[model samples]
Target: MTLLDGQVWTSDIYVDGWRPGRGEPWQVREPATGNIIGRVGTATTEDVAEAAAKAAKAQHAWQNTPYDERAAVLRRAGDLWNVHSGEVQEWLIREAGSIGPKAGLETHIAAQECFEAAALPSHPMGDVLPSTEPRWSMARRRPVGVVSVIAPFNFPLILSIRSVAPALALGNAVLLKPDPRTAVCGGVTLMRVFEEAGLPPGLLQMLPGGADIGQALVTTPEVRVVSFTGSTAAGQAVGELAGKHLKRAHLELGGNNALIVLPGADLERATSAGAFGSFMHQGQICMTTGRHLVHESMHDAYVEALASTASHLPVGDPHRGEVALGPIIDEKQVARIHRIVKSTVEAGARLAAGGTFEGPFYRPTVLAQMEPSMPAYTEEVFGPVAPVVPFSSHEEAIGLARRSEYGLSLGILGDVGTAMEIADSVPSGIVHINEQTVADEANVPFGGVGASGTGSRFGGPTANIEAFTETQWLTARPQIAPYPF
Candidate 1:
């Protein structure tokens, strides 16, 4: 729905399965055109507390719900997702500023997560333990009660669903706080889908606001777990709050990922992968290849080929034809990227391809001969800019990759044995061979290490074990023993 000039649509914040919010409204703007897409209700602290208490109350009944019923609800939600995918995809493009391909991938992954989580109830729960005494002992996983999910604007659907689905599947209530910029698409849409799928009232809460709401959600005592996805600094704050309350925290934070191009690697394949890894969605992804490490033997040729490939990538309006690169999220992000590019070039790096912007659109950029001390090389440049550095030997390449504090994902292009060796040595959570650093399959764990995140995986069915569950040991005495008092 396009709003006329001076008109703004207001979307309410969901609490206790209803919109009881009367707080100030936060304006949601389309990054591509700077138009008012909608206005999301800014949840107050009281709203968060009420949501938490309601979720806790709702979880008491949900936890005891039959496994079959829970599975059916999730499956129905998945079905609804497919039915409304066209509309949801349009929302993603408009709200999150995602290109067509990126939006499709995110929507597909969100639906798949619901389907995967649907099977969590039927999966193996616990194991029996051999006991020395005349007793039977076993360990089983149980729901952690209420969980809080804080998602970022980029890939909002997938990030939120990855945690929300598992929490729901494990019979835990969820309070999701999506980035306010994407409130309608990521928050209201999810709540509607579950509600339409016969999910009980109060089982899920959707609050759209700024960091205050996120802080309130994490610090709420009734929230048993906090699953957060955003910048490293924000994740750290959430982790601290979770720790202070002794609540379980699962974090997927920022990443300055690296993609290595070896001497004998397929140049065409490497170039294509590098271009996609660096420029997709204007490189807002956490796992986007921020650094391209090339072996010195092929550094010059790789730089030229990569620059040529990146330059040809379609960049403009997301609603237009076959756009490979979309606008940066906002003016602040565009300015930050330009600053990084300018500083890197001043520090002796060469700008190979693109380094300009028209409105919010930042052309795909390549910086070669980058030193480790350069900000673009060391920091997470969350934009369509790849800083290339040359490594003379295998040891140097490994050292260069390891020098960063973020060990989220790594890509190495080489033979199988060599790739395996490099992958084994790298401290990243995900390592791809002959591929880009960014890849998210539904069945594999997706997260990071060190400052990148809290080292918790958030994908596949196993995600249920990460943030929404706790292990309990139960024992039965077969023979009664006399107690000495």
Candidate 2:
């Protein structure tokens, strides 16, 4: 059941010991422990080309399947996932290292969103231009064919489902390349649900592997579009390949999102929110509130509150709900967090609470007297550490928040009018008022600008309707008489 030495992991990928030669195996390490949980075939460039070729050969027939039929299949898959949510939750905790509550919520949300795809507009309408001579023009949304999904380790289940579901509903066959760490379990579970729900064989496939596999999937000639979510460096790499191959790609990458607390901002609410949000999952979240812009007046109070909250979080096994904080994804990620914190302190920021982490056990930390040029300040600190920067004026606050490669999400806590203005000025695609940057619901258009990400997810109509479809313009000129002008 485990892939090793470049072997395939699932029975689904083979018939009588047959496997894709191009997919050499890759390792999956548990984030909490640097232990190898499993291994799976990592697709080579040729493997990606072969898979895309298969999709091209089979995609048109799938695209012809009725919308209702596709919708029904996805709905049943949702039901199956709902029933087995606990098992999936266990896998998420074991692999991704998120605690019980967050993991459970993610599973619930990801599973339900599969059904949400059923609501996607099957027949995108085009209207005729009002003309006296009855000359008509219209447009239609059609599948682009062979959509490829490259998901991240932090959100292997949710991101994978979001990208592939909409594309599948719109009638494109999807090639899923999940993050190697949390890959097989969640992905294999959902795809099985779809198969049981009546998705035809070969219509949906999940290739659980690593970077080599990902490069294969995107560079394949037959893949019309690719959707990716990960680090900025990886995004740039993948984005480049997709462009060179002339393939469309949707990217959701890194972020160093900001949460500002002004003079009149709710002190109690902001502090509690800052702690829970920033430390959640040890801050391995893209939209985690890393930059805290506190007004000079509330600066001390907010930092103390955040520190008090951070100090109390218990870290260990994730299944316990009271354990509030769990391990960071892995030891390597722990090392990165250590380096950033060390660099920040060396660059003259004072640590108010936590600063050291061992293995995956990162202490929930807070820093005051921060400098913007520090790695922890400007880059995405994907760990359970929060840095507090004081601003003398509102204008200065906004200016400080804008300094990041990530523009994923922003938060403003203050008077409603001022909050709206701050939200409008912030460059992120998604904004939250009187809330943390990670406060997103099921179906809101969520993405970012700059290095954060390229496309949005959870779009109620627009995103769901157009994520994987193409538009064609149709024109009808009054039946031009035979060969007459």
Best by TM-score: 1
Query: In order, what is each prediction's RMSD in angstroms?
Result: 2.5, 3.2
Where is model 1 more than 4 Å wrong at Cα?
1-9, 478-481
lDDT of 1 by residue, 247-359 (tens): 87888999999898887888888888988898888899999999999988888888999999888888877865668877788899899999999998999989999998899
lDDT of 2 by residue, 204-261 (tens): 6677666777887887777888888889999999999999999887888898989988
Query: Which ten-residue region of model 2 has the weakest summed lDDT?
Result: 2-11
Q: Which pairs of residues clash in candidate 2, taking residues 3 or more apart in a chain or in different chains?
A: 6-25, 24-42, 31-329, 251-454
Displacement of residue 421 (Cα, Å) in model 1 is 1.1
TM-score of 2: 0.92
lDDT of each: 0.86, 0.76
**Top candidate when judged by lDDT against the true structure:** 1
Model 2 segments beyond 4 Å from truth? 1-24, 34-36, 121-123, 130-135, 319-322, 455-458, 476-485
